[model samples]
Target: MDAVADHGGSLGRASALFPQAPLPWIDLSTGINPHSYPLFDLPATAFSRLPEPARERTLAEVAAATYGAPSAANVVSAPGTQILLPRVAAAVKPGRALVLGPTYAEHARACAIAGHTVAEVRDFDALFSADIAIVVNPNNPDGRVARRRDLLELADKMRSKGGLLVVDEAFMEVGPLDERMDGDVGRGGLVVLRSFGKFFGLAGVRLGFAIAAESLAARIHGELGPWAVAGPALEYGIKALGDDAWQQAMRERLAADAARLDALFADSGVEVGGGTSLFRYVKLPDAPALFETLGQQGILIRNFIWDETALRVGLPGSEAEWRRLEQALAAWATRRQERAMEAQP
Candidate 1:
């Protein structure tokens, strides 16, 4: 089961693994906002027509403003950042690729797909030697952050040698704002990937962006050609990205929820590891046990294939969901305490 566990948001696999678990499971897998943006009415033309070029440009402008890019020219909107991974990796001719590790698995996979000799490296300095280097800002699951100065220095070094540095800012909405590299992509050799679905809670929308210098941005745009984004995605991106008031309020709300989750974990005797507001990281010796307990209770979270003592649990949506999680933890806590006592000589 550990080896087969792939990406998050897969209830089908969860059901298959734990067939006796309750129905209507609580999924806390991906770092997606549970309190999603309110669905709005879309015009009939959205589904009936091919996306308009003007709407694409408008979406780019909105993304540029929302993500702090220099201009719309520096942004290339795509269906999702997942699809753009290979496109960005293929920007420079295939060579060696280094991804900062124990992070998202897709970066290494995408680089390999682009015909690069991909390696996941622990040392930040080792990235400088690769033809393509990748980093996940406020890194996934662990929330490890890289210094802005260090990243910029690396970008400069990569640019000097015609290499590329790809920064995935998928979690930056709730991350440390000071270490953001979104504004520095204008200097070249750096391409920043931003996900609309994670922050806005619209993963089904399939919208994301790549920010880079004009030339590189144009290269990605050329590969995408026309109508890369759905009309509904353009509509949502325009409305959601433009709504700063909602974004600010949601950030505050998510912060409070994350704090509540941390307290719940601590009270239940599980010390939380670092994570962004959207998810909480847990490093426990008995992670598989906790996973089994929660999965039996119909609550599925993220577990890593590479690390046995790792789990990534996202925020629950409502009060009932919260209570369910609390109850599940209470049971796990009692069981853990009994096991500890029995093991004591």
Candidate 2:
């Protein structure tokens, strides 16, 4: 099979492929929140001048509280988690890097690009002696979460060897609170990466944070230099991170939306394997056909190259989009039934 698209949210590419498809595409390709944070007007200085140090400090403080990070000293801001991944990989001297398999591809890619010998392992046992170990908690595309105790154990082992354990909790916001490791960062060699865009639905703002020990965070901050996060991103992030009421409401909403998505898949005769509130993972024998059919209907989702039988479906933003997805799934089911009948002897 050809390589699955490296990432999702590529409506432009989808449109190019299916020129005759309808407009106003219903994009559920990425795990980004559909219900975005309400944007507010910003001061002219937010656009005219460089981001104030005070604003940056405030954002970090808010992020620390939101992430339950140990302290502001442990938080480092960046343009996006994507930008920080490779930088963090490079900052840690290239060595034996072990990544929890079939998770985010970027972790291995970043390590390899930084000259580390990267290996994909299936279990935590393999991480004990590795110079670096990376995991995506509530693993993307499948939402498999490693227990916090296991992760802390691995981190302790790696720390003993003067190694690092990097956990990408990009989707953890939609997961259980106890599964997070942000507050555990002071354990000497644990680093937690948080994405501001996925949960808040502001990918365009390009903001993310890394929570680690003060020394490591300072290293990352120095590498990022001054004003790594844009002014607008700083302003927006400060507000969004500070809004506890909104966060609580969004969690409940996303959980309900995920259940709705699961029901849709079940009714369509698709089997849901696992996933977080933001997306569901389906295992179908004809996953490629389903992906193509949905794309033809101007509905895009995520498919993994390593697992051809798996397709990741994100939640629809509105009721209209939900109806569209339901109709498309109904059509797919009908076609499958017709194909089954034709194959009968």
lDDT of 2 by residue, 163-220 (tens): 8899999999998789899999998879999999999999899999999999999999
Please give each candidate's TM-score.
0.98, 0.97
> Which prediction has the highest lDDT against the true structure?
1
Superposed Cα RMSD, model 1: 1.9
Give the local distance difference test score of model 2.
0.90
Model 2, position 13: C-alpha lDDT score: 83
Shift in Å, residue 16, candidate 2: 3.1
| Model 2 TM-score (2 dp) | 0.97
lDDT tens digits, residues 183-244, model 1? 99999999999999998999999999999999999989999998899999999999999999
Off by over 4 Å in 1: 1-5
In candidate 2, list every pair of residues with a backbone clash: none
Reference-based lDDT, each prediction: 0.93, 0.90
**Model 1: what TM-score?**
0.98
